[model samples]
Target: MPSLPPLLAKPVDLAPLWLVERLARLILSSVLKAHPDLFERLGDYRQTRYRFSPADLPLHFIVVPETRQLTVSRGHPPVADAAMTGPLVLLLGLLEGRCDADALFFSRDLSVTGDMEAMLALRNALDDSAIDLPSTLGTLAGPFSALVAGAARSIRSRALAERHATWN
Candidate 1:
């Protein structure tokens, strides 16, 4: 496949942020509805702002725990209480609890900045919860939930495989 020039690639890369942002908000809303105590577990950090950056993509997401809002954009904010950065696969793996946080951090595949404590707390909370993105998103699909979940898993697997292939 021919690579897109930088000028063209910029917009192409940014396009997904819009779709991702909308989907993220919907998923978050469903998650909050299912788990009302999500914010309560966040404690003082409930009000803290967290930024998630996907290193391979031109995208960032600022999440406000208190408001239960997640804003996806093309760049990081001026400031964030805590920021976690990694490739999209690593981020998804962490989210799905399929990857070991400690191993990723130690291996430098993932990074955290600003409020370490808040990040740790967030990590702990995530660890305690059963967050299956595909299943979660499937729930929103109602009757087609299983099919949606299966497609999501398939897409994720293919993306991960492609990413791994590039590393070799």
Candidate 2:
């Protein structure tokens, strides 16, 4: 099989912005539905926009706290209350609790700009929840839960491995 990065690069780069945005919205809504606590915790940032930029990708997402929406776009928004920038792997690691946020921030692996309070609140809320993306996705997959979970885990592992290989 082709390595993950090379296989994904072309398709992801070629995908239309509208398609990406719609997919992101669907995924975000599903995740939020599976974990209502996450939405509740984000209530403090109601009506605010939190942008997430995966430094290595030509994409970014704006997360709306009030509506629990995630909109993917090609460029960073002109104005956002808070923005988190990093490689996708690092961001996923932070979300999965696989690494420490402070360490990553101190080491400059990840960065947060704009509202510090909002960022901290988000970090805290994520840490407080037991969010396993693959598991959540599996549950959302209904009867195909196991298959979905397996595929998610496989993809995650490949992505992480690719990142590690590049670093080393």
Tell me the TM-score of each prediction against the true structure: 0.79, 0.81
- Weakest 10 consecutive residues of candidate 1 by summed lDDT: 1-10
- Per-residue error for 88 in candidate 2, Å, reads 1.0
lDDT of the structure predicted as candidate 1: 0.75
Best by TM-score: 2
| Displacement of the residue 67 alpha carbon in candidate 2, Å | 1.9
Most accurate candidate by lDDT:
1
Clashes of each: 0, 0
In model 2, the clashing pairs are: none
Indicate the worst ten consecutive residues by lDDT in candidate 2.
Answer: 159-168
lDDT tens per residue, model 2, 2-36 = 13364665687689989878867766777667677
- lDDT for residue 129 in candidate 2, whole number 0-100: 69
